[model samples]
Target: MFKYIKNDLPASIVVFFVALPLCLGIALASGAPLFSGLIAGIVGGIMVGALSGSQIGVSGPAAGLAAIVLAAIATLGYENFLVAVVLGGAIQLLFGILRLGIIGYYFPSSVIKGMLTGIGIIIILKQIPHFFGYDPDPEGDFAFFQVDGKNTFSEILETVNNISPGATLIALIGLGILLLWSNVLSKKGKFFQLVQGPLVAVVIGILFYVFTKNNETLAISADHLVNVPVPEDASSFLAQFSFPNFAAITNPAVWLTAFTIALVASLETLLCVEATDKLDPEKRVTPTNRELLAQGTGNIVSGLIGGIPITQVIVRSSANIQSGGKTKASAIIHGFFLLISVMLIPRLLNMIPLSVLAAILFIVGYKLAKPKLFKTMYQLGWKQFLPFITTVLVIVFKDLLWGIGIGLAVGIAVILIKSYQNSHFLHIEGEDVDDGKIKMTLAEEVTFFNKGAILKELDKLPENSYLELDVTKTRYLDNDIIEILEDFSTKAKNKNINIKLISERGIVENPPSYIEFFKLRPKTSV
Candidate 1:
């Protein structure tokens, strides 16, 4: 890992810049203290990254959990919510021990794509107000219906009446720098490659804020700037850490919230693990169980220190990978940066404009939900496109998990429809064959849904006809299907239909019942 320090160290800086605002933004969205987000970021980087076996996946406070966190904090008091976070971590540890990590693999790809696109659109929409210097709502709030009772579109309209000229200018400038740095400067030399665009935008934002302080028209307000909590002294800094109320452990509501956090955090972590593996240059597979263990530990520590919930977030992890991160060391390093910066130069961070951070997120959002992605999904046909678009629209109007659930439902319906249609095919070998000499070929996998079609086909066979039932290509023949074929065989005999059953095990010539002849079992393994 040390050998790759040259690559990892610089990559860590980029991730640090990307994660800093996100940590604060998500906290704001969650209705938690801004410091809590920083604490989660620190723990995710230092604690989780240290324990995790992943080469490049970075963990932190997640946007996906913002709605849950917000609702939980409101339902349970803030102190009680901390207890839930700690218990949630313990539950995650149990999940890893039970080897339930494989459950993450069950989510369909269409739903996942829809999730990614939905989040991207949310990010873009949420940041528009910040980008324009309208800071009535806090950064990192990604919900369609906000805590202030305004929807995403309504907020954007409100921003028009109260746009900050200073913020708008700096945001435009920061976006220009980001675009140039990524598209032009980065390709020019190693210097540009090593220097991330977000950092440049932030530095310029700070300078612009400092120089324009006396000019009211060009001056961004304190509300439109990064607001890191600054402690007056070392003791005051130490006092910022919050501990959970142990008394809340007995509260049933607390337990319910904890379970919700555990379930959501674990899912988000697993999905991020899959996405990170895809982004890894070496394609190293991170142990999902180990990842859960690591994340559990991080969340426990974060909760103890009054931090928001942590998960392996795709945005920061993808940024690290894109910035050429070599190992988990980059993640660890970024954590330390969060710790040290908040402790030492939080005042400087406070000077950075919110608009600049908004610009950076705009690029991240654009990357996640590109126009090409929509076109590509559409070209793949409705089976994929329907779920993808549905996820996007639902997430845009509702929340993350709801969008995912709706997409998954659509995706499953498509699969069932396709299965029913493609269950089997009937073929007559000879040209002059309407004499019920039919060959019925089963699909590779016949489920209960296919039973009706199979039954329909068998019943249509005329009397005294030669029927051949083929299962040679099938790997799994469901019990329902097996029962149908077995019952049909008995009925066929009464009709004087000569039934020939063919399978990989050999052929049977209407000698016995279908169940007894095939040695049917409750479940068939492929």
Candidate 2:
């Protein structure tokens, strides 16, 4: 794990910076205590990172679950909600035990790509307001419809009217420094590479705030800066932690909330696992089942100590990857950073500007949704491109899960259309205009999806035609199709058509019982 400490250390710092505000923001959005977000971030990073199989993925309090968490807390109370979180973790453990991680693998590649791109675009759009210092909404709110009354575009327009000169200036300078460090200085030597651009940008942002504290036009405000909770003393700090009410475990509502969190967090984690693996330069595959176990354990720990639900978040994971993270150590170290920073130097952290972080995320977003990718997807043809674009657009318009769900629906529809077109192949042998002798070959792995196409071909056969039905290449034919063939046989008799069935077992002339014939054969020969 320490093999790449040089890389991991710097990447961890970058991830630490990215995860901090998100932790606070998600907590605020969820209507949980501010300290609870940090607890979740700390637990997610250290515990989940230690247990997870992913090399680059980062776990933390997620924005996606904020709405659910908010509603759960309101309905069940914070202590009871903590119980649900703990129970949710237990359920996630069960999911891992069941090896349900395979669910991550089932999402189509196009949809995954779309998800990444869509999220990228959202990050860029969402950050624009913060970049200009109009941060009415909490950080890490990725939904199109924000917790703030305004939507994405409305917020951007709001930024234009309410721009903070001080914040905007520092943001521009921070963005410039990042561009220079990444494009120019980093390539010049190893030292530049060791010190990440984001860390540099953040340091400058802090210094800018400190130096211009009294300057009217150039001073950034507390509202436009990082807000880590400041503890007066050890006893007050300890007071921040809240314990779950175990007595509420028997409540049906608590169980429902638990199930909801488990299902949603698991899904988001699985999706992030898929996206993070794709973003990994080394292309390492994360064990999804192991990730579930790790997440479950992390959530359990987080809930016991008063924290929001956790998941493997794509934003932090992508930030880690883009910052050159090489191991789980990066994630683990980021957790420590969150823990240590909150405990020791929260005052210093409070000086860092939100715009600087937004600038960093801008780069992250641009990388994910590069224009060249759009052209590349289009070149792959609509079969691949449609789902990719659909995922991107829907994700931009809706939330992550909704976009994925809608994109998956579109992808399935495309598959069905292709299946209908390719279900069978017909050839008229020894063609003599109207002689009507034809051979129909069924596709491999025929399913109910192909029923319409097969029935259409059968209906097109001319009167007195000799029809050859080929199933030699087919495997696992659907029963619905067998019924279609059985029904076609009766129609064939009335139409004076001679039908022959071909299979690996033997050729049957006008088989009276297609169902019985299939049943007698070995399963492999179907």
Q: After superposition, how far is residue 222 of candidate 2 from its true place, in Å?
A: 1.1
Candidate 2 lDDT tens digits, 415-478? 6775675555322233324556688877666654455556557777788999878888876565
In model 1, the clashing pairs are: none
Taking every candidate in turn, the Cα RMSD to the unseen true structure, in Å, is 13.5, 14.0
Give all candidates' CA lDDT scores.
0.83, 0.88
Q: Which portions of model 1 show Cα errors greater than 4 Å?
A: 422-526
For candidate 1, write residues 1-526 as lDDT tens digits: 7788877887898788889988998998898988899999999999999999898999999988998898899998888899999999999999999987776655555667778788888888988999999977766676788777898999999999999999999999999998999899989998887777778888999999999988979998998887889999999998888889999899999999999999999988987886676557665657789999999998899898899999998888878887789999999999999999999999998998889988988888888888998997786568778888998899899988789788878877876775775555332232226665777776677654454456556677788889887777776554445655666666776788997888776787885766565455233422
Off by over 4 Å in 2: 423-526
Ten contiguous residues with the weakest lDDT in model 2: 425-434
